[model samples]
Target chain A: MLGPILETLIGGLLTGVLYSLVALGFVLIFKASGVFNFAQGVMVLFAALSVARLSEFFPMPIAIALAVVVMIALAYAIEFLVLRRLVNQEGIILFMATLGVTYFLEGFGQTVWGSDIYKIDLGMPKNPIFVLESVFPGGLLIDPSELIAALICAIMVVALAIFFQVTRVGRALRAVADDHQAAQSVGIPLNQIWLMVWAVAGIVALVAGMMWGAKLGVQFSLSLVALKALPVLILGGFTSIPGAIVGGLIIGAGEKLAEVVLGPVLIRMFDLAGGGIENWFAYVLALMFLLVRPQGLFGEKIIERV
Target chain B: MLYREAGQFKTSYSADQAIFSIAQDRWFVMIVLLLGFVGVPLVANQYLYTEVFIPVLILSIAAIGLNILTGYCGQVSLGTGGFMAVGAYAAYNLALRIPDMNFILVFALSGVVAMLVGVLFGLPSLRIKGFYLAVATLAAQFFLEWAFARVKWFTNYAPSGSVAVGKIELFGFAIDTPDRKYLFVLALVVVMALAAKNMVRGRLGRSWMAMRDMDIAAEIIGIRPLNAKLSAFAVSSFYIGVAGALWGFLRLGSWEPLAFDINRSFQVLFMIIIGGLGSILGSFLGAAFIILVPIFLNQLPHLLGIPLSTAAVSHIEFMVFGAMIVFFLIVEPNGFARLWAIAKEKLRLWPFPY
Candidate 1:
């Protein structure tokens, strides 16, 4: 009993860290542009595809570097082509535009990188390591790649925190997130701020893409998985970075643990055909949270100005 | 002079309440319907009826359903595919088990099933709004897709987890051939389109518009947000569900759970985006555009005699389609319906400045 529970918890936490990485990208773009950025998932897939294609002939680091450059160029292109024309449109309209971007990126990514699945050789060891032998007797098994993901996620969070606190551009991003007109009034270039945020979001997406690609192989489904982080965004609060991390961890652990424990028990108990509740468990959790607290765990209270 | 309603006097409410008060507009619809029902069926080959007209008409019905929620009621739902799946599977189950069931009744019941699911998913809307609500609907989308895929009962214990509907019969007539199926779907779509038009033009529609414009303010004006929102969801879902039934039964003939995936939801959404939101005419226009553009793009290379790989052609089509979506949004965010209205407005005063 103890062994199973410990295994589920550790496994959940590691996957949760990756969810946090994806959710962080969502939070960044949502805060900066207030658009919800439906294309974030596609961006991740696009980045992963770029990295996978580049890494075919080049070293991993160089491929990653080129991927980052690709992402930056994408950021600028999006801002110039889509966002510039859509300035001052309704939030939903902008959101729809991002949906358009999603279609464009999906097509672009598949065409450029080829739609066939490619395994990302990140050189990260994926062997299982057993620990807590004294408590569980049989011990709990954990993957090395998951541990690396968790560690890298922690470092990324810290670096982002410092960048927000110590950097001038970060300050400007916050300002723009706060109030677009006010940010522009204070000598911060609005377009440049948007470009910077998108570039950062692109980088975050690249990280998430690499992590998820390494786990699931570089394929079409990667985009869909990134979208699964949406409920995490809503749970953590779209505007709050810390909220995203916490929400990601919570959703990650919640779904994984539930899938491991509750799924089979419920299936057997109720005579269900099979147990696949992981798809909706996190969503239901988020829906429940939204009902009780419409603001989310860390989202600001919505005050409608008449 | 060709399209003017200047001299049309309405001495009674019924005259004023005519669907097309304008003489030319009334004539136009009649001509179109005449062409669809009689002339087209006589001349159109199997390919046009099956490949283009049937699919377009069915999809338009679904687009209209979505327009009610997203365009009219101001609720953005991403679970349209799931709702449609509910309709499809329900119809499938009813048709499979109830050997004596009426085909029309099966379609109606399918709509009801989808409506119930829509309302269930729509429960989140009472608390959440905007993008949050959209994500909640997404939960419904993923969950339903999972349900149909994993649950054996929905698929009637099929080894492959896919269920196909057999030939549908209405009264004494069999709708087996493409032209017959096209006519059947067309009749259903036309009736539903009329129903939708009247619904939007009536009291219930005003309430929906009020709720959409501003829920709190609408509540202040004595409209129950619950009633308004749920009814919109109910009606919208019913249309989509029936459309799904037709799509499965008539168009695809057989479909798996993957048929109504997230991409289907997005496709319908795009139809509304490009066609025109908040307009029934736009729903048809949007569906037509979405269906035709790809077909046209696919045929373009062949027309040019370019020997490109099928995969490469599809990729180029995607690129073009994506670029067009952005271009359309940038050029006219209000969509083709609005553009049509602009053209008509311009035509009323043609050969004159202002």
Candidate 2:
């Protein structure tokens, strides 16, 4: 029992880190645009599908490199073509546009790569790392790839933090996030800022896609997991990157623990006979969080002026 | 000119405040209802009734329910399918446990069960609003889907995790036939639609609209946010629950939890969005649009004598449908119901510029 618990915790941490990566992309876009891009998950699927197909057809390294470039281009194309035209639309309209984007990308990805799931081999060294046993506390083991994923996430988060805090364009992006009108008053080109932010978000999504694809294989179901990030965004506050990471960890660990511990108990209580709690565990946890703290763990308190 | 309402003059407050005050509008609605309930079953074939009419009617009922919440109350939900599943399963259990239970009573009771679930889930909306609220409701969707799928008793311990109704009857007339099923659905839809139309026009409806417009202001004006929001959830779920019963009992006849998946929720949501968010008439129009468009798209290629695989056709249909959503959002974000109102406004001022 203790062994499985520790193993689950380590696995949960790794999964949480990956979820944080996806959540970060959402935070960046929501912070910048105030539009919750429902398509973020689809973008992950699209990126993974692109990488999987490219690697299949071309040299692995070159395909990975080209896939990154394609994602960046796609990001720029979306910004230029669709989002550019929708600059001043209502928030709901923007949300709907993203839904449209979700559909388009899903159909487009399936069309390009076919709907079959593909095994993605990124040529990472698949050796288990001997980490401190004390950390996990009971012969809990983690794969080297997951540690690498966590490291990558840490680096990405730190890089994003620095980019936002130290860079001029980052400051401009911050300005836009604060107030679109005020940002314009400061002579920040709103359209350019939006395009740049969207591109950055795309990059974040690409990394998330690669990491998740490595774990789950490149498939449409990956997009569904991306939907799980919405609750993370809610819990972490839409505008807070650190909040996203923390929220992801809590949700990830919480879901796994619930499944392993309380799931069977509830199943027995309800006389459900067969235990399967992990399926809705995450959502139920999110819902509980929503009821208690609508602003989320790190979200700013919403003040309505009307 | 045939649609003119020149002599329609309201003399009493009841007449003035009537659902269809305009004589022509009333006549037109009555005719449509008659055609739907009585006429369609007579003239339409089995395929039209089974594949088209019953499905459309059931979806319209669900759309009307969603419209009450999202359209009028301004509480966006992503759990209509979940609530529908609750209703479907509840009805299934009610029918199975009480072998001699009335099918209609079971259907109505299933709606109450859904209402309870909707209210339980709706508790989050009290603190959450807008997109946050939508996410909260999505939790309901996934949770309900999982519960139904995993819980063996919910499916009556079915081996394949699917549920089916035994048979349905109303007063010893077997509703097994397609035309009979269509009539049953059409009758329920008409009754529910009328109830919805009336409800939305009353005090409760006004309160809901006020809350949707501005919750703070509505609160200031003494409308209890808890009451308005929860009632919206309750009533909306009640309607959606009944529709789910019909959908399972009449339309699909057998289904897994996937039948009420998130995709179905989005389909109903898109119907309300594209039809008219706050209009009862829009629900039907939206449901018709959503239901028929794919069918029409699928048939068009075949009708044109083009040879294409169903998969390819479905792909094109998705692309076209997705593009149409963006188009409608851009063209008239208020929805197809607004378009109808605009046309009516124009018709009221025919042959005159100003």
Candidate 3:
């Protein structure tokens, strides 16, 4: 029992890292533009589909490079067509516009790439390795893909942290996030910053899409992963990147544990057909967190003055 | 000149406060209603009723419900689908268990059940603000969806996790036909819409609008946040719930839990946003546009002599919807209803220039 639990915990933490990858894009956009981008998930699907299809005609590395270009192009298009027109709108309206983007991307991706399940082979090992053999009966088995994902996620987060702290563009991005008007007053080009931020978010979506597409196949449902990341966003504040990481880990671990351990107990207690509690478990947990701390675990404290 | 209301006069408070204040406005609405009730039934065939009128009517009610909350009360709820599901399930249970209950009462009771659940989920609104509250509502959506799917009791232990209702008989009239169903739904919608209009026109609606505009300011003006938010949730849920029941019973006839999923919620949200928030008429316009545009898009390949696959058409439909949403948000965030209002304003000053 302990061995399986330990295995699940470690596995969940790795999956949580992947979730954090997706949530990070949301944080980047929210921080820069104050837009709660519902399109991030669809953007992930779109990016993955682009790479998967482009790879059919080109080399893997070139496909990835082209996909990055595609994402940057998307950022420009969104900035020019949607974001430019929607400046100074209410947050909710901006949020709704992102939903529109989500719809368009879903259709556009499918139409351009076709809706079949496309494979994204990153050449990551699929085999599971066992560890702690002496401590556990069958040993704790772990997937190397997940381990690689975790490593990649760690590197990305570090790179992002450095970008935000040690670079001029990053400082500008932070300034824009802090106060749009003040940032503009200080000679920051709001349009350029928005374009840059959206481009960065698009790249993040590309990385996330590659990871998720390799794991789950590039399909329409890849976009639904956005729904999963939303709970993580709530656990970690919308504007905090590190908070996104921590929140993802907690939610991922809690959901897996509940699905594996408490699932059967509830199944027996309620005479349920089967255990799929993880679907709602993360959301309910986030909701509870909202009640206690609406700003999230690491969010800036909200001070409402009438 | 005909559209001008310059000569209209009101001698009493009732006349002044009439829903359609202008005499021309009153006449237009009366004519439209007459056409809807009498003209439509005679001309509309089965396909028209099933594929168009029924759905537009049902969704309009749901849109109105959502408008009441998001537009009027200023509380954005992504859980409208869940609240609708509650109503659908509640009505199903009531109708199934009690064989002799009136269909009208069953619908009302289901709305009430959805209202209670709405109030429960809405408790978080007081603590959470703006986007935070919006995200929190997803909890209700997912949880309710899970319950309806997982709990065998809700589905009456069917091998398949879907529920079906028998023919609805209201006072010896079997409402199994399409036109009959449309008429029943139209009558209910008219009544409910009037009630909704009155509610918004009264103090409750005023308080809701006040709260929506600025909650803190509304609270400072002595409107309790708890009461205002919860009441908005309750009323909105009740309206959405009835629409859900109508959707399940009248529209789909037999369905699964997937019928009222998050997609339905988003669809209704789009209706209100495109229709114009905070306007009852906008709900209907939004519903009509949402329902009709897709149908029209699907047929464009045939009509325009474009040789496109069904898949391609659907994809284009999605792109169009997305582009339209952004277009509307940019050009006119108030939606089609606002456009109509502007047209009316222009008409009121037609053939004359400053």
Superposition error at B203 for model 1 (Å): 1.4
Supply candidate 1's per-residue lDDT for B174. Answer: 91
Ranking by DockQ: 3, 1, 2
> Which number leads on lDDT?
3
Cα miss at A111, model 3 (Å)? 1.2
The list of candidate 2 runs beyond 4 A from truth reads: A85-88, A130-138, B1-7
| Candidate 3 CAPRI-style tier | medium
Q: Distance (Å) between predicted and true CA of B195, model 2?
A: 0.8
Q: After superposition, how far is residue A226 of candidate 3 from its true place, in Å?
A: 0.2
Clash-forming residue pairs, model 3? none
lDDT of 1 at B70: 92
lDDT of 2 by residue, B78-106 (tens): 99999999999999999989987888899
Fnat measured on candidate 2: 0.50
Order the candidates by lDDT, highest first — what do you get?
3, 1, 2
lDDT of 1 by residue, B142-179 (tens): 88998888777888888888787787888979989888
What lDDT score is found at residue B152 in candidate 3? 88
lDDT of each: 0.90, 0.86, 0.92
Question: How much TM-score does chain B earn in each model?
Answer: 0.98, 0.97, 0.98
The model with the greater DockQ, 1 or 2, is 1
lDDT of 3 by residue, B1-354 (tens): 878888788889999999999989889999999999999999999999999999999999999999999999999989989988999999999999999899999999999999999999999999887787888899899889988988888888888999999989999899999999999999999999999999999999999999998888999999999998999999999999999888999998778888888999899999999999899999999999999988988888899898988888889899888888888899988888889999998898887833
Name the top DockQ candidate: 3
